[model samples]
Target chain A: MKLTILGCYAATPRTFTNPTSQILDIKNRLFLIDCGEGTQVQLRKNKIRFSKINHIFISHLHGDHFFGLVGLVSTFTLLNRTTDLHIYGPKGIKEIIKLQLRLSNSRTNYGLFFHELESPESEIIFEDEKVLVKTIPLKHRVYTNGFLFQEKIGDRKLNLDAVQNYEIESCYYQKIKNGKDITLEDGRIIENDKLTFDPVPAKNYAFCSDTVYNEAMLPIIENVDILYHESTFLQSEGNLAKKTLHSTAKEAATIALKANAKQLILGHYSTRYESIELFKEEAETIFPEVLLADDGKSFEF
Target chain B: MKLTILGCYAATPRTFTNPTSQILDIKNRLFLIDCGEGTQVQLRKNKIRFSKINHIFISHLHGDHFFGLVGLVSTFTLLNRTTDLHIYGPKGIKEIIKLQLRLSNSRTNYGLFFHELESPESEIIFEDEKVLVKTIPLKHRVYTNGFLFQEKIGDRKLNLDAVQNYEIESCYYQKIKNGKDITLEDGRIIENDKLTFDPVPAKNYAFCSDTVYNEAMLPIIENVDILYHESTFLQSEGNLAKKTLHSTAKEAATIALKANAKQLILGHYSTRYESIELFKEEAETIFPEVLLADDGKSFEF
Candidate 1:
């Protein structure tokens, strides 16, 4: 899986910094998360194709989180896109998007689907043969959710030499890859483990932002390979973070530690800070494995 | 009067080029016109203070023309602005803006007013003692209007030597500046023209965009000091321009010529063109006094 940070700053987009938005490439699908204002320009600058974004997930209805949505949808129509697009967000997203399109007299040529999510419980929102996405309920001033993307386990790998030595027919190779023992022509039995090897472990990534540190998300995102959490404030601004329903660097690190995530990625830094290095430094004190998210930065795991 | 081009492209915003938006400074008021996406960043880049802008004029409901408005309004609230903001646009603008704010649960601290315009005739939309703003209706894909900003006639300049020669009292100087004949203490009457010169000629600026070559706008913007018109295509693409309800550079210059404008500024160029120099060259063919609008470029008239 590959992750690209299109924008990581908070509250407002600046000349050099952008608001919250990211792209996750997993299971041959590109998922957009929280498209803030100016996201299309950021997408263009990052050289990401507009057609590749099939699914968009908005964490909340805040302008800093989803104001760029309508613009992106309008641009898609302008480009004459025909592929069906799916949007998963909190309730009221459809009204906001439809109203703008209606006023502009722009009827989208593509099939636009909105899956309004209001459930506060952890439930699978999207699933396919290769991947599964679930929502992690979050604590915020408004209803918000964090998405957890998990790659499904693949079929076992066949050991060609072992299968040939066991006199297994080529047609039985499929059965062997499916972890089933094949009967020999002479009525001899062979164990399934002897014909195949275990497949590579599936990787998991969790995205959380615009929410305060909530232990309720631990069970939903437990033992994830990578966790991206918002660190909108420093440790010194803990009061401000609590008041605003945002998290501090230490608080995000504590959540990552409690969830036992392999690595923690910090983003959504408030613009009030002069530098983002302080966030990493503060997070490292609690969680040793931490990465700072920056605009245009990409990570492969 | 001074005009600053915050963004002047058409259709969409790019890395270096922006969509339609500009700032017109007249009579100590900064009026924002056609706020496209990413306009707030452009405003910041141009070093324009948000507090100075009290009025915003949206030409139409197109995404490229007014998508940045809500973000700007949200940012103003975040900055703790207390001044009232007035927005003038189409009839449906209030619904679009109010819905987004309601969904986000962001109640603005300042007073927010919307003036919806659906008229097809020229009428004054805004006026004070020093300035007056009228709408010049334009033909486009949707309901649209071009704004005409005119500085009201100012107080006549006092000719100090002429006033002293007439032995006019200092208290009567105010009356003379108001274009009234003054009676001296010795009962001698002095003509108003002799005591004071006529007020400076009222300067007028007309902003016309997203329109085709419609001669109906000539009377509304006639004899303006400066005229900014949309030139979305070149003369070679005149057919496309007409189909899109846009104008070519040649057509814009023709309007400037017919209206007898002092200067013509060409903007809203389509991104398909390789260079903007072609627009200036083509427009100058019909109108000798022509200026090209570029991002961050300012004009004084």
Candidate 2:
């Protein structure tokens, strides 16, 4: 899985930065995450294939988060897209998109589906053969959800040395890779573990933003392979973060540490801060595996 | 009054150019006309004062016409605007904005008023002491209205020669300028026209885009000071223009000439055209005063 940061600023679009928007590549599927205003332009700037996006997960309804959604949907219609698209967001998203479509008299040719989250409960909204997506109920000024993406268990890997040592027939290698115990022509039974290796552990990505530090979510996001938490302010501006229902670099790192995430990506910095080096330094004190998200930067997981 | 063209391309937001968005400065009012996807950046590039624009006039629901509106409004709120802002557009515009606000759970401290147009009739939507705005009924794919902004009739101007040579008293000059016959201190009665000239002919500016060449509007826009009409295609693409309910450059020029406008400003070029010089050249064949609408270029009326 790879993650692309299109924009990561908080309140409004700045001269040098953009509002919230990101694209994540998981299991060969493109998932647009938290689309904000100017998202299409960001997509173009980052060279992301716009039509390949099959699923969109919106964190909340803040103008900074989903205002670009209507325009994007409309652009899709204009571009004559026919692929099915799914949107997972809060309840009001349907009304917003529908109203714009109604006003414009636009009927999208593609099959557009909406899965709105109403309850603050952890519920899986999407599941395919390769991945599963669940919502992370968050505490915010409004009803908002963070998302967790977990890759499905992959196919087992065949152990060449072990298979040869066990004298397994070549025709039985496929069965062994499928984690099955197989019998050879000599009436010798080869155990699954001896003939095959365990599949790699599934990778997980958790996205949490526009929320205060809630230790309650630690269990939900625990052991995530990669975690992206919005650190809107620096540690010195902790009071401002509290006032705005945002998190500081230290708090984001604390969440990452408590969740046992292998790596933490901190972003959504307030426009007040000139440089992000201080944020990385502060977060490193609590979690050493920390990186800052910059616009157009891509992370492969 | 002055008009600045921010962008006019039809379909997509390009790296070198942009989609539909323009600025009209009338006296003290700065009106944003048809905001497309990258209007904020366009405004920044043009060095236009974003906050000074208190009113946005959207011609229709087409994404090419007004896709950037929500972003601009959100930027205003983030900028901590305290003045009331007004939006005029098609019927569904209010709900589109309100639903986004509801989802984000954000309410503005200042008033956000929407004057949604529903009836397909020409009517005055905005008026002040200096300017009067009336909608021009148009035929399009969706419910749309072109705007006609006319400067209000002002107090009569004092004929300098008559005021000085006729020895008119300063106190009586005011009455004569009001188009009333006045008596001088010498007991001589003077006709209103003899003492004062007519007030500056109310400058009228008609703006129309995203509409076909509907000659029905000639009466409303006849003999205007300036006319801005969409030139989405050249004559070679006339068939496409008809299919899309758009106008060619020659068609736009014909409408301008028929309306007896002083000058014709053409924009909203189709992406197929590499350069807009052909548009100007075609338009000038019918109306020699035609000018291409380049982004950031300003026209004084």
Candidate 3:
């Protein structure tokens, strides 16, 4: 799995900094999360193909989180995109987007679909044979949701030497990889585990942002391979963070530590800070694996 | 008067090229015209004070012409702007902007007003003591209208030597500047022309874009000081320009020549061209003073 941070700042976008937006590539499928203003330009800077983005997930209705959505959608029509595009966001997303398209008299050549979420509980929003996506309700001033992306386990690896020793035909290799026992011509059955090796483990990633310190989502993101949490303020501004319903760096680290996530990624920094390294220093006090997110940065696992 | 080309290309924004957006500074009042995507960043890059822009005029409902407007409005709120903002655009502009603001639950502290235009004839939309703005109807695929900005004539300049020789009092200087004759204590009348010289001639600028090669607006923009017209293609692709309802470089120059404009600026270029100098060359073939509009370039008249 690979993740690219297109923009990871807070509030308004500036010349040197952008708001929240990221790209996640899992199981060779690209998923866009939280498109802020100037996201299309950011995508071009990162060299990510606009055509590869089939699914876009918005965290909330805040301008910082999803303001660039309409522009991106309009650009798709200008580029003559034909692939189906799916959007998952809060309930009002469809109305806002549809209004702009109608007023501009723009019609997409591709199939456009919206999956509006209003549930306050953790529920699977997307699932396929290779991947699963669930929403983790977040505590914020607005109706917000953070998504959890999990890659499904793949088929078991084939033990070529063992299969050849058993004189099994090549056509039966598919069944063996599916974890089925093979039978010889004499009707004697062989165990499935003895013929194949174990498959590689799957990975899970959780994205959380623009929320206050809340332990309610800990259980939902427990043992996640990677966790991206918002750290809009530092510990020195803890009071301000709470007053604004935003989490501080230390608070995000505490949540990551309590959830037992393998690594923690801190983002959505306020532009008032002189350096982002302060957030990393504050987060490292509680979490051992802490990483800072900047625009155009990428991580692979 | 000064004009800044924040972005002048056509269609979707790219990494190096931007869509249609510009800043017109006339009579010391900043007016934003046609805000495209990334215009906020462009404003920052151009070192323009955002607070100075209180009026925005959009030429059409195309995405490239006004996609960045909502973001700019939201950013103004984030910056705690208290000044009123006025927008002049097509009839559906208010509905689109109000819908996004409603869905996001954003209430501006400043007054926001929209002046929707559906007129098919020339009319004055805005008039102040210092300036006048009128709509110049154009032929395009949509209900597009170009704007004509004219600086009102100022008071006549005082000839200090001539006024002092005529023994005019300081209190009467204001009257003299207003083009009034002065009567001396000796009962001798002094003509206004002897006391003061004429004021600088009023300058007029016309912005025409996203329109075909039509001369319907020539009378409205006659003898304009500067004219900025859309040149989406060169003369080689004039047929394609006709089909798309866009103007070629030669056509833009033709309009400027027929209107007796002092200078012509060609902008809104299609990205298919390798260089922009070709546009200036083609336009100069028809008009004497042809300027090219490039991103970040500025013009003073």
Candidate 4:
């Protein structure tokens, strides 16, 4: 899986800094997360194909998180997109986007679907044969939800040597790979474990942002291969972070450590901080594996 | 008058090209016209002060024309703006913006007002002591209106040499500048023309964009000091321009020539063209004094 950071800063978009937006590529599919203003331009700069984005997940209704969604939807119509597009966000998101489209008299040439979320519990929002996505309910000033993407384990691999030794027919390989025992015409049964090898482990990625230092989500994101958490402030601004319902670097690191996340990625930095390196310095004091996210940066795992 | 082209391209915004948006500084007041997506970043790149912009004029409800207004309004709140902001656009603009703000639960610290326009005929939309702005109704795919910015005629300038020669006291200088005849204590009357010189000729600028080659607005924009007209296509693609309800370079030049404009600025170019110089070449064949509007380029007249 690959994750591309289109924008990672907080608050207003500036000349050099952008608001929250990212692209996660897993199972050969692209999912856009939190499309902030100027996101289309950033998508162009990163050379990401616009048509590949089939699903978009918004964390909240803040302008910094989803203001660019309408522009992107309008641009898709101009580009003659014919594929269906799905959007998942808070309950009020549909009204915001539909109002703009209606006012502009713009009708999309493709099917547009909105799956508004108002639930406060963690539940699966998307699932397919290869992947599953669920929401991690978050605490914020407004209704918000973070998404968890998990890849399903593949079928066990066939051990050619073991199958040949057992004189298994090629037609019976399917059942062997499905962890079923093979039966011969002589009434002899061969164990499936002897004919197949273990499958590769599946990977899980959790995205959390715009939340405070709450441990309620720890159970949902425990042992995630990669965890992307918002660290909008530093340790020195802990009070301000609490007052604004945002998490500081130290608080994010503590959550990552308590959840036993394999690797922690820090993002959604407040523009008031001059250097993002300070966040790494603070996070490393608690969590040994920490990564900083910046605009146009990418990571592969 | 100084006009800054924040974005002059047509259609979707790209990494190197932007959509429709510009800043017109007339009579020491900044008037934002047609705020497309990514306008706030462009404003910062152009070094424009956010506080000075009290008024915004949108030509139409097209995404490329007014998609950036919501983000700009949200940014104003983050910046703690306390001044009133006025927006003049087509009918339904208020509903579009208010819906987004309501969904996000964001309220501006400053006053926000919208003046919706649905009239097909030309009329005055904004007027102050120093400037007057009127709508230049244009024919487009949607209900569109360009803007005409005119500097109101100022009081006569005081001729210091003449005033000193007449030994006029400073107390009567205000009356002299107001073009009033001076009456001395000895009952001598001096002509106003002899005591003051004519003020600099008030300049007028017309912004016409996203419209076809229609001549209905020629009377309103005649003798304009500077005219910025949209030339979305070259002569080779004039058929497409006609079908899209956009103006060709040659067609725009014809309008400028017929209107007797002093200088013609061409912008809102379609990205299909390889070079913008071809537009100037096509326009110069019909009219002289043609200038090309590029992103980040400024024009003074």
- i-RMSD values for every candidate model: 0.6, 1.6, 1.2, 0.9
Which one wins by DockQ: 1 or 2? 1
What local lDDT does model 4 show for residue B86?
A: 98
How well docked is model 2, in DockQ terms?
A: 0.63
- Report the lDDT of model 3 for residue B232: 98
- Tell the DockQ for candidate 3: 0.75
Across residues B1-301, which tens digit of lDDT does each residue of candidate 3 receive?
9999999999888888888999999999999999998899899999999999999999998889998888899999988999999999999999888877887777888999999999999889889989999999988888999999999999999999998887778999989889999889999999999988899999999999889999999999999999999999999999999998999999999999999999999999999998999999999999999999999999998
> Tens-digit lDDT track for model 2 on B127-167?
99889899998888998899999899888988889778887
Worst 10 residues of 1 chain A by lDDT: A166-175
- Regions of model 2 farther than 4 Å from truth: A160-174, B158-176, B189-198
Every candidate's DockQ is 0.83, 0.63, 0.75, 0.83
What TM-score does candidate 4 reach? 0.98
**Ten consecutive residues with minimal summed lDDT in candidate 2 chain A?**
A10-19
Q: Model 4 misses residue B201 by how many Å?
A: 0.6
Candidate 4: regions farther than 4 A off? A164-170
Global lDDT of each candidate: 0.94, 0.87, 0.93, 0.94
Report the C-alpha lDDT of model 4 over B81-198, residue by residue, as the tens digit.
9999999999999998888888788788999999999999999999999999999999998899999999999989999999999899999998888889988778999999999999
lDDT of 1 by residue, B1-301 (tens): 8999999999888888999999999988999999999999999999999999999999999999999999999999998999999999999999999999999988889999999999989889999999999999999999999999999999999999998887677988888899998766788887898988888889999999989999999999989889999999999999999999999999999999999999999999999999999999999999999999999999988
Q: Report per-candidate TM-score of chain A alone.
A: 0.97, 0.94, 0.98, 0.97
Quote the lDDT for A153 in model 1: 94
